[model samples]
Target: MEKNEKNEEEEADEEFEEDYEIKILHGYENNYYDISKPFFIYSKENLVNFEILDSILPMNTSKNEHKSGIIECRYQLSCFLRLTRDVTEVTNNLNIQQFKYILMTLKFLKAVENKNITKLLQVLIFNNFFYQKDYKLRNYNLHLIQILNSSFFTQIDFHLKKNIMSSFLNSLMIRYDFYDENLIIFKNSKELFDYSMFSEHIPYKNLMINNFDAFCSVENILRDSNVLIIFQILLKEINIKSLILNNFFRHLNPDENFAFLISKIEIFKAFTISNYKIPASPFFLFCLIVSINNNIEYLRLENISYCRLNLRGLLEGKKLKGLILSKIGLTENASLINESRNVYETIEYIDIQGVFLNHSIWHEIFQSTNSSKIILHFNNSDIEEIFINNLKKFEIQKNSVLYLEIKFNSNTLPRGFCNSLIHFKNLKTLKLDGYIIYEDTESLLYKAIYYMKELECLVLCQNCRNTKPYIFLLQNSKIDCLDIQSTSNNNDAIMIEFFRLHKSMTRISIKDAKVSSLCLKEIFKQKNLIHLCLDIDILPPQVDQESLTFKSKNIHNLDLCNNTLKYIEGVDILSKLYRVHTLRISKCNPPPGYLSKLNKKCNSYVKILTYEYGILDFDDLNRIGKLGNLLKLNLLGCKFSGCSFFDLVTSCKFFKSLKTINLLNSNIKMKDFQCMKRFKKLKRAVFSFTEFNLLTLKNSLASLQICKLKFHTMLEDSNYNEFCLYLNESNIYILRG
Candidate 1:
């Protein structure tokens, strides 16, 4: 009976897992904190589709947190809205839009439930999260004072008033002490925490006084808690896996609270500190390394100038699985070899980039490591003949190394390095960058790949070698992913020969290698290709009588950039890729009626279409409207000055499923912006670097329920004030240049 019950539970879990998916959709071209371009969380099964105003906010992944934030919101809000005493009836009346707002609002409520609003304000101020938006408030300190002295304060509940006063006072104290010590306005606002300000609310008079007294005692500590408090809150609340400190510890010293917190909490699985300049004392660095618990698996240091020898203590515990050092300055190399020999047996991954290491030290570390499965990434580092000879002789890395990337500063490999690559028999992924492999070395590299029976992905970038090395691996190897970027000119014939020979690569991205139409024809014949990205110049079609037909049915994404079509053959080639769901064409000059042809071929297949830095006339816009399945339309930097925006909107009337439209740096008229309200499903719109008129902006504010709107860097400075005023009236203040 227990076994039968276990089987039933497993079946139920499988069913649930198949139906649930939480996806995050980022904006077209915006950073995390831009409220005008917030990330969207979409989930169909959970009824949790909403916009997170701050994209960098930690996602609530724990079951308890998710249940409390979303499920509790539904429960409490339903209870409050129960008119007929039926929760089902109240919930049924609410639409998906209403549920979105409810979820967004309750997420904020859950945040402020445990954390004081004042503390959050102080944290944002210290972390510079609000530096961009604070200026839009126009003397934010004065604005806060105006709001506090308004009649709105007299309307809240007595307990709520006391809580507000306490939070406001605490927030002001932190700003005055830490954020800007020289600001006279904050110094003046520091006098508002007195007993006279709260005498009207006698119920919590003594409580407020005690709170103020407690805050006063910690005033000195708060001044030194610049960004440490942010990290403390994150470490306390979230189970972070990686702790990254970039450009940190310029001259600041850690307080006692931070030291205590670091000692108490379990160390992160991975820790990284990069771009550090100031040299810290050896003892201080030793203490910091000793504080980390044995749970650490990865330690990364990049561009650090301080305490290179002291950082060797980071490998002391013999528990780390990965060590990544990039552009690191080493004062003493002999000590690092000794430290690596102790911990190298357990390390599974090693990435050393731009670090000057002697040949003996490299040979010693490489010879000592004995991990079962290892990944080696070496970039621009010294790997002399001794190390390469050792690799060929000992073969310690042969059966263990699964991933290897060898990138050199010059476009040339060390002598016999390509021959030694054959020793990594278990390599599943190999990347060789900045290497101009000649025909002989290229043959050797392909020969090495032939021996790597487990190789699945091969990437060769910035290679100026004009050779068809992939031809050697076509029949001998079974690599499904091939990425190549050539810096030499006129490799179309070589590429054409290779593509004609191979048809097994499931993903192919070749950049900066100009290919003719004939070369593209050969690439399209690969039936297993799922993604094809070519950023080369597409020359005019060559004389060929053979039909140019696409053979791949699995290709869902086709990205073609910097291609100028001088003939209709290129358009015909693109029209043949009708199976693609996402088609991105940038900086391409398509012949007239290109969209009409695409609409006829891919009206039902394409869902996400991006055409940037091209001309889109009225007829083209009308043809785009016929693509009924388009979910996102990105026309960034397209010349539409000659086309009427209102006509485009009215012609594209079948965008029922469209959710996002980005028109950044486009010639869009201000009055025609209100016509976009016709697309009811449109949720996010970006019009940055465009002109805006206040009259149409007013109408757009009233009519459009756009969850994310961006009008940053408008063209005309004359209308900036009025445009900003209208946006402020609508409470859409998340703007950035």
Candidate 2:
């Protein structure tokens, strides 16, 4: 018994030690590659930077063409305006005139950013650089293109038309920071011909060659020398800015074909490679990155972090700007960072997460960034403290670092640590996460927060079991923005006091807190609460369901995610807000027939209803259809097998109101939907993982404007040819399984 106790104690200490500091962080996976979870929160959606209107909006010509151009722009703008009036319109119609759909969407988004029409849409679309909206938009376009390409290529005898391929590539090129979710839709050489032509029209800058989705190996995919020729053509034509060869190392065959492509495309502005395993000497993609993207400015290496390459050969005369050496370290006295200091003083951004750099070594690395600003991300509070304390050692000019984000792993920072932050008076943003605090932690920490008088945004998160209400500590804070996550709401008084203290906060994320419906009433009282997220799994019994309907006219977005609304009394409270524009509900199975009662009681002005993963019945669909203003209805992974999908579609009277009916991972039949009369209002019907027969069905899909179908059963050569022939004659798109 004593031995077991000792072993358990040792294990606990080890766990505590492990959590305190992360030596090497997979920041890439956390930020971009995690396909399991949604990339952004439901309320705070990351959108594209439509502010690049100058680039996307038709360029101005001479004064002679200005009037005619203005007329043309207005004409184009009107088309976009019509599309944005409802989400259904854009969703339903994208397949009909795909080029025009993409072009108008981009142009219309410029107006949305400018708030030219529809005040509700203008607010939802923000083009903030910090949000990296352009990246998200590319991902959306890529996913769409993946679906289109999968079906479109199967129809062609040889390859895609240049005009068609150019139109799609142009849509992908709008954003400077390009990413395409790297969905390699090309199946054979014929499709590769279309992909090869992409750089001919637009300035192809950013690219991720392979996104190891299901296809981990490049074995069967690259059948011959045809792909290599295409790669060579792309490199010679386009000036590559950012190149990401992630998920390529292990799968890349150690052959002359792979080596030839590597040797061909050698220079880029920035390069990133993550999750690569070192095979034989043939696995020289890493060497190719250093030698090739030869004009390298920003370089990031994750997972397989270390290399025995000669640092002098890689860094000697290069003007490198940013370095991300994650989860790996410098070997021996060959500290590459120190060597670079002689060439360039400081790299603009150095993100070192999951790796422990001892204080002395870290200080040397910190001193080498540019004067404009040095953006650094550390996952350990100890490392963060080391950074905070070592600021004086580095000769960074005053106000050089205008913002600093300090993220904590587990350590509740020492009081002096907070006090030390004020020295960097220009610090505008501070974020602390995962650290739990108790009553005895400190009141002085509040003074520490107060000292950063220039701080504009503060995010405090504590969701551990021992997390206590710590709102009183913010009494001295002048920060206007707060995102707090608490574990317990035992003290209603404390929560009320918290709202009272920061009553004017513009945005907030309250999740897993002991906040009940009554506490939410206090939250609704905030005048500037434009965005409110309620992610509680269960509301406490003390919640006042009969809580008075509050008038929060400013509130535009409401996200009720992963929370049970079955017990909540005032689920209809949202109906009272006329300004509510977007409502997202996910992963909550309510009691049968609850949606009908709620829809009748509430008249929510929700324009977009994004529903995912709840066994919704036909009545639920009927109830949702009853919403007077619901424009777009997106159903993902929800079973509709119990009731015929067409029965639900035919029953929906808001055919004009709901423009898009996208069903992914649900059960539906092709023949039943053939008699889709009411579906005329729907511009598009996307069926993914929905069981449908394409072999026996004699269904005419032309009635439903534009339809998309994904087949399940593998097709024989004759069947594939027949399927292509059938779809080519019809408006329906058959996406490959």
Candidate 3:
């Protein structure tokens, strides 16, 4: 017994020494890549000085004309409305129809000095350099054209397109400081084509390639010359900081590929391999990442099949800062060691998205840890019952965890999980989804939650009706954001009580639930709520619309999506809210005079509005045209006479702030779309799936202020290529997915 205790003490000291070495290596200078940031949060603030809009509006444009034109002197006033009137005019010398192309090229030069290209776009647009182009300027123009073709020009004859793409790449390779850090390769046919065209000029820091959802055969991928060249280049040259290989890496020669990767393992910081069947022993990857030469901070292996991963050795590692294992399986009848040591002291994030593990492996992860700000996500996963029991028996405390999510996948919670959660007292955000809870466990959950003093956000999803009354028990806590879903019938009383108790709620989302008049009245009485999302069922037959006035004047964003109601009773109260500027309503019929009431009450206040899959009459169009601050109007799948709609909007004398208009799936007369030339502030126009009158569109383009156009059609294959080439020749920026 004394020898066993001494052995255990020696193991603990060795683990501590290993952890100290890893912490010194990672030294708080670099931040781990946050995979949680949503993709829609485009950091547009980085390029505000450049005139590029980086329009994310879903629009597509198609036409038949291919003639390029010169920048007209008359376009100065319309294009530079934001600049002073004394801005110099170009001498009609250069033909630059859309200035956004230059803007995009400058944006793509991520590592280039911004001061050199700071005024480059404005000078090219407002100067005479295009006509009397010097040799250097001509080369620059060729480079931009090549980039445009490779990025957006997706016509056929890819082999021939590579010839034109080489000049720009040859120039780009000379600029050693300007290397692409983030490259997405082989995710789709378009991305594949782009890589094929630019494979010879490969320079990347962090590469992400996906073959799981792509419609590409592994045999064809292995035979592709471009893929081979890129792999060879990556092995020899690129010091890849982060690498993601999805599904296709398993088919290659493992010996050669693994050898080259291990040769360059010292430079790798993050690595992910997901959704494939591995060979017998998976320790090749595990050993490579955790080897002494490599300090890989993040490791993710998801949905791996046919493998017996050595969990004991992986858990003993001390360098990994983020570890994610999702739906991993072991080979049948596989045997491993039933031993565990101290948990990883350097791990700050552990996301287990569904894995089958025994008590020992669980103990290796939850046995002990020294991290102070760990973020753990147990999404759609199961934990060992013995592990939970051991946690309670040993009296282990996990107060270092800051953000915790326990989202089960159609599974019952282990016996003592909820009772054990009171140990996470420092938790700030907690999400519980898709669990089958009994009344006793529910009470225990509330009791555990009441101890979380630092908790600010709580999300409860699935089986919420059973969990409703206990939710109000959180009112004593200081949670400012609440999200609840799957509340069944007659939840109005519960919601009313919740709102009354938690009047300080700032952001609320109640989806897949039902609420009545009394509940809505209580909701609007909250003076602090800023963002509200309600995807509820039909309102009751007897709603008092007169009583539903604007009590919450601070609400800025209101989303009522997927409602089955024909006419939402008190939706017109949106017009009376002083600060409610953004409204999104989809798949719902409005009440009698919805827009007319808005027009009369507060037409000039609303800035962004979207009404999709509904009908808009003539009066609705007229009223929409008069919204003074309206910047974006998306009328998707809404039927109306496009001719009359455009005429009313262009004829409006009171409103000119509209910058984007999306009329997708609407009946449009492109001949009357020419009337859009009268709206000088328009930056993007999308009329996809509507009529494409080529002649009228060309006639309108000369006078329009749009920098981006989204249009396409169900044309013959030959005509589509010609349409793409024509747009490229005409200098109109085309967006690719």
Candidate 4:
């Protein structure tokens, strides 16, 4: 009895297991099943045929049992039967075989719910049984329905949304029915069409227009700090249409727009539309702008600031027009902006300030454009190859160009630049300051000056040292107005030779130059000089005792300040320079005889004498008192023993012509300066660097009627409050040391 009861329990358990497996498979299949049957059922009520299904039921099966058994067989099967009945009721009903196959597919799907079973179903769907084209046995629509109803369908939707779907469909189409399947599947579902995957399957390209939000999402993803992977993936998939690519870049943050992108496209049309703050990349923006191969006529990048960009490759392009890059800090290659193959035809005007450009870049730019107007205000020490190359190019276009201004700081002129000047054929005006150049290059500089046949005005205001020899060589070079000052080089021989060579040269200046009798002799050779600056340490040369003479009569003005001459025996010869209207001789040790002779000789012209820091006794002053034409007198740095020198100056009637008087460092007491007021024409009076008491001097000078008073005192010992008050009260431009 115990064995029989156990056997009964075992048999029941086995029956339960079989039923459970069938139910589990049915549930799995139902998950992937389409629920479109309800729509079909609601739409096809007129074509519903209950008679067609009446003959299919088994005998003795009640309506309730038939309905329950059908529904319980499999969820997919019940869905298919319902869909078939709905389709039959519709006007265009599905055929019998199609309907039956659909039902069978639904039943098969019921067993494919398990992952292992679903994989097996996928293989079966692609194999001969389901994939064959023969209508008698295999049906593609039925196969598709079965596969879609399996659990694998849900996984497909999750993993292969749109992109993967397209990729998978494309791959299958390529492998089977290459042309036909690709066209059919692509037409049905474009979202599942990947061009790369369908290359072998179809010749037609499947491209989608980039959506606005899609572009924004890509840009946002790229902008995030840790989205490099996303950016790379998007880049790979993104199409190269200009509009789409531009939109993607438009949303990038200002600081994120680095040089990496600039190096790739070269042209940024939207640069003017968006004010994206540029990244602080080391490469310069100008280099990038000039390097792009595309037409840049309308490119408007206003405030792009960068350090330097390589422009070596950009020199081959057509000229760029109206290029404006200002207030940029460019390093090493600023000159490259002007260097292009056809730069002359394109670029017109350029203004670059506070940019650290290499000289070679400038050389190329100048050579390429022959720019009519260029303004470069650079303060750099190094000289580059661009300087020489540019000069050569400038020389080539000298006839047509108008304005060129350059301000740079250097210890000497750059190498080869002096020689390159020969190319300035039509240079009208040239202004140079603080240029350090090599001595050997000076020899070649004459070639540049010789070529500049139309050079009119030249200004060498500061620091002309290494090129003095070259300047001397350029004496015959065409020039009208020449201004030379503060050149501290021992090239006196060269100066003399220059004067001798350029006798036709109108304006000549030897200010603050160490000149001797030999240099003065050289000056005598220039007969047509209109302006003469002889302000030099005129102490007689150690070897020479010969008296110097100014035989030229064309001298209009002469500055003979800072000279040492005790005797005026040479004046008889200087009296021949009758064209000299203004004569200045300061800081000289002149004897009574010399002063008397000078006064007698210069009686017809305006004479100005400055006696500073030397023994010019009352005798000398008495002699100077005889000069009736004296205009201005300065006695700075002089030692006087008594008030007799001042008395002599005050008594002279010619002193009324005095316009300025400087008594700086002269050993005269403040009370003694009271005599200066006697000169009615004294416009400015200077009492600087003197040992006189400030209060006394101010009190004495206060009574004098003068337009300007300059008092320079040692303020180190002065009271700060008093100094400030004095400065405020006195409406003067004061400079204290």
The numbered model that scores best in lDDT is 1
Task: Provide the lowest-lDDT 10-residue window in model 4.
Answer: 240-249
C-alpha displacement of 381 in model 4, angstroms? 5.1
Q: For each of the candidates, give the backbone clash count.
A: 0, 19, 5, 30
Please rank every candidate by lDDT, starting with the best. 1, 3, 2, 4
Looking at model 1, residue 141 earns an lDDT score of 33
Residues 134-218, candidate 3: write the lDDT tens digits: 2123323443343333423332123222222222222222111112334444432212211221121122245555553331332
The true-versus-predicted C-alpha distance at residue 671 of model 4, in Å, is 2.2
In angstroms, give how far residue 139 of model 3 lies from its true place.
21
lDDT of 4 by residue, 187-247 (tens): 1111111223222211222222122233333333334322333222222232211111111
- After superposition, candidate 3 runs with Cα above 4 Å error: 1-189, 192-296, 303-309, 312-317, 329-343, 370-396, 413-415, 471-475, 488-503, 514-518, 525-530, 537-543, 546-557, 562-584, 591-613, 616-737
Arrange candidates, best TM-score first: 1, 3, 2, 4
What TM-score does each of the candidates earn?
0.53, 0.51, 0.51, 0.40
Q: How does candidate 3 fare on TM-score?
A: 0.51
**Cα-lDDT of candidate 2:** 0.48
